[model samples]
Target: MSEASSSLAYRLRSLRRLETFACLAAVIVLLLLPFVLPDFYVYFAALVLVTGLFATSLNLVLGYGGMYQFHHAVFYGAGAYAFALMLTKAHAPLWLACLCAPLVSAVLGFLIGAICVRLSKLYFGMLQLSLGSLVWAIVYRWYSFTGGDNGINEIPLPNAISSTTGAYYLTAVVVVVCLFLMYRIVNSPFGKIFQAIRDNPQRSEAIGVNIRLHQLKGEVIAAFFAGIAGVLYVVVEGTVVPDMLFWTVSLEVMVMCLLGGWYTFLGPLLGAAVIVGLRTFTGAYTEHWSLILGIILMALILWLPEGVLGLIVKPANSKMELSAETGRK
Candidate 1:
């Protein structure tokens, strides 16, 4: 290899090592956060972790699979409500309730995806929004069953994770595991095929890729993980509300993916942290937190189109792309 080629290879290796090191450091810090942070901040940190997982799950379909999951929070709310209802109404065992929650979300994903995947782009998104709004409406008005708009409160949790610190640890572990699984899914052959379909559905269909089936599977997978996030939120907050299924929640998650750089794997997680931070701090100071957030997001969208994490990784990615082009020549 030429000296230049060797240098490019070295830089690529360095970037990989740096990424691995940064991930490890982040894990260490997350594990230590509960112990080090004040009580309130610890609780706040837990919210970040849960929201991160939720946003990341949305990113799996929205960013990687190239699907617009406009009503993603429907699955989230479904999971939360399922778990809460199983515990409170059905009197189910803790283990069973926890196990069934995500499954419920996955089933909803399948039913909804089977229909939504029939359309492309804008139509698909619109159909999903319509269906998701239906679910939210039911939950909002079903006073006898779902407690109506008032929502279910004081949800029963296990003794082990009832404490804030314990709950934080549980959230941390679950989020890490779910993220690892999602990362593997995106890098797997199935993920590559989905991306191919995303880039060129006609070409993928000509190649016998079964685009709709793959899209459906992607929806189910994303919904399942999103359900897991809902379960975590319920565990942490001990309540389930109709707002969890609202259109605004879905929009917020979409924004998280955009702010974090949905195309990049960790972008949504970072976006979640940035969003939570902004909401918390801005709300503390001003009554118009949403206005402040809108301005900040607009600025970021204009200036850093690739997202905050995308900006950080852009140089490395550009170098890698250059190396590939040179080798092709």
Candidate 2:
């Protein structure tokens, strides 16, 4: 190996060690957070996890698969409605309601992606936007079922995890497990195929890759996770609203992914946390919060164009490392 390659390898090893240590420390803190934090803060953190998971689901498609859809949050809303309806109307068990949420979104994804997959880029996004709007209109108009503008309310949690503290811990554990599974999926062979298709669809197809089928599965996978996020969101908020299914909500998630650097596995999560925290806190202090948020994002774009985690993981930036060494010396 060349000297540069050796140095790169060493940098990667050191980065991995740092990441592992940080992760362990974070896990320890999270485990003890409920005991130390106020009840409201714990509940708020649970919602933040849900939001982060939702953004990560968007990243699975827009970042890794190189697909853009303006209506990705349709699955999230569908999952939210599914969970809410299953609990309130069907009277299903908590576990069963959770299982059905993702399944419902997967079905929607499969059906919608069947047509959208044949189209390229902007057309795919527009079609999804149209379909998502159609669903939203239906949900809004169907007052008998969806509660229309008022939305479904007063959702009761299961006996096991009904408390505020119980729900927050459950959100943490579920999101962690789901994210780990997603990390494994993204690094696996199937993920490689998705990346290959994203990088070069024509070449991937020429090499005997089933482009449409792979894309379909990717959409379904993304939708399934979005569904999980939505269901958790409903449980956290105790209600399901039509606004949650809007295309604008999906745009917010997309922005979060971009803010955090979609190329990094944990970028979406970090971006979600930052955005959610900022919106929650800033809204309380100022009426010009949206303007302030725009300024902050602009700064992030200029300084950390690759997203927040990109600051740590850019192993090939030898000049920056050298500059840091010179400063230290």
Candidate 3:
């Protein structure tokens, strides 16, 4: 190989090592955070991680699978309600509710995907948003069962994990496990098929790929994870509300991924951390936190279209691309 090629390979290897080190350092800090920080910030830390997982779930479809989903929070809402209902009405064990919450959302995803998977672009987004909004409205008004607009309050958690610190640890465990599974999924052959369909639908279909089935499956996977995020939220917060089911919830999760650089696997997680951190700190001081966040996001989007993390990774990627182009020439 040429000297330039050798240097490029060394640089890429060094970058990957740095990336891995950073990830490990983050995990360690999070593991030790509850012990170090005050009680309030511990809860705030849990919220950031939960929201990060939620954003990662949405990115699985929108960024990786090329789906246009507008009301992804419907499944998230379903998960929260399922967990809340199981606790309050069914008197189910915590483990059982945890297992079932995501399943309920997966079922919801299947039903919605069956209708929306065949459509594309604007129509798919519109149909999903409409159907999801309808469900949200029903939940909001179903006072007989759902507690209506006021929402279910002071919901109980399994006694062993009731404390905020304990709940944060539990959230950490679930989020880490789910993130590992997602990492495997996105890099697997099945995930590659999603990419195939997204990149060349006609060719993929010609080669016997069932586009709709893959798309629907993607929906189920994303929904299941999003549901897990909802479960974490309710478990940590000890409340379930109608607002959790709203379209705005979906927008928040989606925006995090977009802001963090949707193309990269870890971007949504970073994006979630940044957004939630800002909200927590900013809201502590001023009521106009949303405006501040909006302005900051606007600037990030204009300057670093890929994401904040994208800025860090861009140099390595650009150098690789340049090397490849030089070889081609």
Per-residue lDDT of 127 in model 3: 98
Q: Which candidate wins on lDDT?
A: 1
How many clashing pairs per prediction, in order? 0, 0, 0
Q: Model 1 misses residue 326 by how many Å?
A: 1.8
**Mind giving the per-residue lDDT tens digits that candidate 3 earns over 160-182?**
57688998999998998899899
Task: Report the C-alpha lDDT of model 1 over 1-329, residue by residue, as the tens digit.
Answer: 47667777788799889978997998999998877789889888889999999999999899888898899999999999999999999999989998999999999999999999999898999999999999999999999999999989978887788788988999999999999899999989999998898888899999999989999999999999999999999988889899999999998888888899988999999899999889998787889977887887789788978888887888868877987778656
Point to the candidate with the largest TM-score. 1
| Residue 129 lDDT in candidate 2 | 94
Q: lDDT for each of the candidates?
A: 0.91, 0.87, 0.88
From the highest lDDT down, the ranking of the candidates is 1, 3, 2
Stretches > 4 Å off in candidate 3: 1-22, 321-329
* Cα-based TM-score, every candidate: 0.94, 0.89, 0.90
